[model samples]
Target chain A: MTSAVELDHVTVRFGAFTAVQDATLSIEAGEFFSFLGPSGCGKTTLLRTISGFIEPSEGQVRIGGTDMRGLGPNRRPTALIFQNLALFPMMSVAENIAYGLRVRGVSRSARREVAERLLDLIALPGHADKRVDELSGGQKQRVAIARALAVEPKVLLLDEPLSALDLKLRQHMRNELRAIQRRVGITFIYITHDQGEALAMSDRIAVMNRGVIEQVADGRTLYEAPRTAFVASFVGENNAFVGTVAEADRDRALVTTAAGPLSGRNLRNLMRTSEAVLFVRPEAVVLGEGPLTGRATEVAYEGILTHATFELDGGGRMTATIPRGAPVPKPGAAVRLGYDPADALVLPREGFAHA
Target chain B: MHSSVGHWLILALPVAVVLFYAAMALLDRRRAPGARPVSFVQRNGIAVSTYLVVAVGVWTVLLIVLPQLYMIDLSFRPRLPPTQMGGPNDVYTLENYRFFLYGSTRSTAAWNTIHLKAFALTILASVAITFLNLLLCYPIAFYMAKAASTTRMRLLMLMLIAPYWVNEILRAFAIRVLLASSGVVNQALMGLGLVSEPVDFLGLDLGLYAGLSYAYLLMMVFPLYNAIESLDRNQIEAARDLGGPWWHIHLFVVVPHAKPGIASGCTLVFMLTAGALAAPQILGGPRTLWFTPIVYDRFYQAFNWPQGAAYAFLLLVACIVFVLATMRVCRLSLGEITR
Candidate 1:
């Protein structure tokens, strides 16, 4: 029941506003893919388009290599788990799980058997007789997933399904969802604004902003080698140093900033614009002994890591995360910040200026 | 102390009904094993405060119990003629109700066919109206509650309410005029050559059906809308995404979710339509004689107060039975329907 999904130059327009523009990607069968973005960044829109709830104003969405043009959500070989779970409150868990089979005109006994099997798979065995409202938040989530999977869809689309749970349950359910996806071996298109969820669960992530996919790559690549300035800033917390390109090489660049010259990898080939921003994660920024200097403005104790925000002498703020037990500079103390050139990425600032 | 046997039965009847209700509630509670055994006051939440208990007791007696007791007493008495008004001969009898099943003592006819036919026809017509209202209102209610945008829903609500502003009598008269031989519908039909001549619409009882349904349209719409509006849009989407066709989506999801609204709406419409007098009188065919009209004639034209009260009580019992039966058929409780 699993298949690959491909989007070819997909464009969705609502009146004059383009929600998703020219999105082209192919998801391999059984891969866990996610569209990660901030709110209003078109990630949900893209997921809806793939699920057939929305028709693309411009291109084709092919599932299992078949063009899904003009197909309604019901006709598509796909199932979506809504953000709210949307479990039919009136029905018992077994009835809710068996809803798809019942609609397909399966025999009552056959539906019950399928529902029992799905219940066991979700680790919620013997929950069939219970009402949806009686289940805990996590149980309800598993029931929702079980409900969607009961249809045996070729592709399963989840729209921020874990957003409603408390943080502890959310983290737990994330692993459970990934395990379920692996077991089922269906292409899963997950949409989330939470980067942690995307990074922890997805095999690859498409970071989107303002109707455009900034980059699509594995979690490690997205974190280590973001191709766009928006991707670098959005996927994780980073220190951005706006400057001009002083020297350029095949894979490296020297940028002149207010803090003086900084050299880093040329991820986006910013030599043409000359204007670029050097991005370095707070962890990558070495403190205590370095050439760059700033005054520590704020310190936050965040369990394992102690974060210190510094007001740079040359310009904007830069943050450094020191292990909780390590020596941390107090607020108002002068500090030095530095990072190796390999840890910093030089991306063109033009696209990020509006963001 | 000098009250007649009818007065004692009137008081005793309510006590008997209350005892039966209590016994039934006990039996229902027993049927569900492992359920917590709750006393009457606790089950009704009347134990929460003395004020609540007193309020409920007073409300039941004043608004519900007293009126029925008085009506029952009225039904059992004979209607005193003008000469015998307020005299000792104004005593209790079963003659009023006997007139319904059997003809008057002077006639010796086996049964009263006219009143019996009127009663049967009224129940059938009310059932039809209730069924029709549901068929007509469900789609509109669903559209307003789930599909339409905020602005469009507001516009639709205004449209639903606009027709009511003209007043029911005037609206019924308007429909009556439309069903006339040379009215707009017939004229248009004849002009379009669909019919060679005007159709006698009133003779078919079409106008009465239309007017009664139109009269209770909002009663059906508002309840159904309230229930459907609270249903999560995601449930419908989830159903659709799972390969459910449109009818299956409604059958498995929307219909079950909207059961309370449907039950309440159908009950109210059926009850109101059964006791309806104006719509039937204004739009009914010359041969049409609804139960309410017969009761009205007994009370006013014939000046037989006892007979009218008896007929009215019988109709009330029928409405109550219909309401209970609907709740049972829909698998909804009174509390759920009211809510």
Candidate 2:
């Protein structure tokens, strides 16, 4: 909570390939910030750059107002929990935790004492003597957390540490990881290709793609208002429409869509003309007798909500998210669908836009 | 290129068949996870039989059916008609091995024979060299696996392995020239006034053994390289990060991970040198007697077909024993070490 890490237009390149490009994000003290993306999206590269595993091709990384240039990973005020966790197979749990302190020349007795306390903090009080190879997956995860925290780093970096675990365990670990991070009160720079993990854990998330940061916002802001189509499509499900603007004015626009006329409020368009792509969340779309009539083609049961894709008479597929317990129409049933016109968040279609 | 049409057919036919089978397997896998799945008897029967047949095929091709039928049968057959010596069949006996084991009155016994000694020395030397080679190769391998993971590191690795381009015999002879009395090593020493007279290294056994060792060093180097190369560097780094210093890191991390590599490399070097006759004969002079030479002498030098076959069979038996021992030592059946 006492330190903030800043990446100043940082870009990382390996030979000819750019891993991260001109990424500038300011993470506040004690904030749990996540870099979220699909695989090969450079979110991991950004996290590594922050950790000093990589030096930016163009700018600087700063911690607590100090330039992190010329600092190696070991020398930085950071501790990184690698994606694989990378726990030493040979050492006992306590010795693993004491690694950083030992590197700093602490005495054996003192390091062990600190390790025991950290072990307790991670909720595994008596596993200090066990080799990492002997511990279960969850225990090993806790030990990795304790080891990273042992150095008393100002910032902790995690790279998809839960990706290897089963779904149930991963869900459980998220709560544990969040609780641990909260207790530690250190800035956490977490990276993952999982949107659910990123959304569930982060105070804020930076959506990245092809070596560029697409958007940096809190989970709610990101979910409710994604600035780009990629972020909207990636972070959550949204049905999109390519249509010409039937009308455009201040705080309102009517788009003549494939499924027919649609109007929305407060939607911005940098496009010169009406032929722009519009995006609307499936949940925002309401189902009833309205201007548009389409046959329900499919229904997907998601335990809580049923997602129905409707094929309109005009040859366009529009989806609606209805509550699972609701009176769902059978497939091939002709139905009318509508939505709150104000909820349609129109976005420009740019192939290279940072979504 | 030698089998142009045949090669293309060989390549394409297999790939097409594999693809077709793979598609079938995928469909089966997907269908198995569904309701009213494929019948258990049919499913399990195919899986079991396919694995059994493949395993049997591999065993026959590599072991069971091939050697006993082809090579052993070749050895049992006389190179010529043997009716004069014995019955029409010239019944199999230890005579071929006896001639190799105990040569003609003029020739020394197999133990005393120079080529026999050289072969035995080569086997023993290759094994001894593997232990020492690990010491040198480990660090280089570690560097390639961990520190030099960058482009420049990969380039440096290519450079290290580049020596393989030169023929192995040329490399051995190069060492021989350097060790020669008037060659670069002696000349440099004399120029440095380290000795008043040239050292007689090449005319001796020590110099020859040294050449043989250096020449086969690359053999150990590559296998050891592959072992160390494929090692997950993070495992070692993880060990080090867990407070392991320079030396213990290897004991706890590097060495254990490279065990399979070590065993395989050792087996390769040991087996190669076990049957080897050329390197020692060229470098170690006439004093060394290798086993392969005894078998050859019994076959060609002496008119003893039975004893020669026996000697060849004995050599083959020794190799088989070694392979079996290697399997046990390397824990091959465990499927981790060799793989």
Candidate 3:
């Protein structure tokens, strides 16, 4: 019911601009995959390459062990749901859904029956006679999905289809989309800039930046053990300390910064005297204990958590997130912060430009 | 009763036209496909004060209705002699219209053809020109709107419009010169060895068709470009992703989306070609006697103003009928066409 999609050293260029540069990846069958990135990161370009909307300037694309050379979008066995949905406005709901079926020479009665069944699947059983303009935003989204599924392709590609919806509806449709994908058991390749959507629904994620794929890993592994500076900063919030490594071991390194010496696990095999950065998650920062001391500068009260920012005595700042119910130290009061060696990550410094 | 009769006498046509609009509105509200039915007030919105409506009513009656009523009145009067022009004996009768129907019966010569046959030929030629312009301009418009880059599209638009900067009569006369027997086209044909002798292009009625088509080229291209420009490109891509072929995609998606533009372009080109007098008179050979020229001859050359008005009135009716039939076939509303 599903097929794996593979890209081998694919590069796409538009005259003087390089859109997607030398990309290589393989997505497994029946897996919910996502490409998450900021805008202009070439995630959409890579998705379009896979869906055959774009032909790579160099290299090959394979789907289910078959080379898709010189194949157009219409010739491939994949369907793309556009960002704006792009349902035919001149058509009724049923006609929009049944369009692919009709194009494939399906009988009129069969098309109607299939359209009706898909309408029921999308939870709009009696909306066949309604025009597209009459439907709500969410209903149009479901109709777009139903229309794509009527062709029953081996892979389904979505291009930020939920970006136009309100927040509440976007969250609701996330669950609905996941449930439908699971029931259909097809490969779903979703593209979005929203990390929440990727983390919640995808089995694995490929974080892209500047036309390059920074990292690809399962959701848990990607969050817990990001390999590069871009991945660490992009996936979630982290307190960064720039310094030089003072001591190195098999799995641990001590970095010397202006404030003090900090110890963390050496995930990137740091060497002594090498420039490095130590990252500590806000949740892992412990108050009232261990090596470093600072004065509390600001305390922000979120609904479920409290974030307290500490200015180290020498330089630099770090934030500690505590449960809201926990008592908070007064602002301007001296505070001590520490973390377990395993909770901190030390890696060689890779310069990453901020937006 | 006398007062009621007086009111009816003044208000009958206006009341009928209003009733027609009401019936159309009701029908539109019931089953207008793919568009929302907007009420007249909704279309005008809160800015439509009573003063605005009254101004529009006055303008319509004064500018459009009164002139047509005068023309109808003139069409029914007898053509009096020069000494008796506007005299009491210039009685209202159907004699002028009867002349158009039977005047050619007195002349068996082929050169003085019947008025009815000429009118029918004019209509058929106009329809053919409309279809030809559509076939030729649609692809160019689609390319300009969808395929060509912005720079290229701008250049193409400039090229299409640059010729129109010259007067229309000047353009037609230029075409007539180019299509003459000893002009550049015939000289090229002879030089290429396709023909040993110069062919008379005017005798073939080619000059008239070419001039008319060129005169109305912009009228066809702009509307189609506008319509195709507004189409969402994603819709075409979606259809392709669903495994539809190129022509099938056009048939199901692009053509239907451009229907309003096509209808408007066809109507304009058809009406202009049908009522054209200058192009035919300049480009036609002795054999090309179109309806407008015949009407013109009646008024100016033959000094028969009543009969000329009758012929003009018939041409107007034919144009209206053609417009209605086209709207019916395309399933477009007057509002959509005007928009």
lDDT value, candidate 1, whole model: 0.89
Model 2 misses residue A195 by how many Å? 2.0
Candidate 1 residues B1-339, lDDT tens each?
223666777677767887898899889888988887766567666556567757876799768897878877888777776787445776767888888888683455688999999999999999999999999999999999999999999999999999999988899999999989989999999999999988998988898988999999999999999999989898899888888899888887998999999999998899999988889989999998988989999899988888888999999998898788867877789999888
TM per model?
A: 0.90, 0.68, 0.89
DockQ of 3: 0.75
| CA lDDT of each prediction against the hidden true structure | 0.89, 0.73, 0.88
* Distance from true location, Cα of A352 in model 2, Å: 7.6
- Candidate 1's C-alpha runs over 4 A off are A1-3, A353-355, B1-68, B82-87, B105-109
Poorly placed runs, candidate 3 (over 4 Å): A1-3, A293-298, A310-316, A331-334, B1-65, B81-87, B104-113
Task: Compare candidates 2 and 3 on TM-score and give the better one.
Answer: 3
i-RMS of candidate 2:
3.8
Measured against the true two-chain complex, the DockQ scores of the candidates, in the order shown, are 0.74, 0.15, 0.75
Give me candidate 2's TM-score against the actual structure: 0.68
| Residue B192 lDDT in candidate 3 | 100
Worst 10 residues of 2 chain A by lDDT: A346-355
Provide the DockQ value for model 1: 0.74
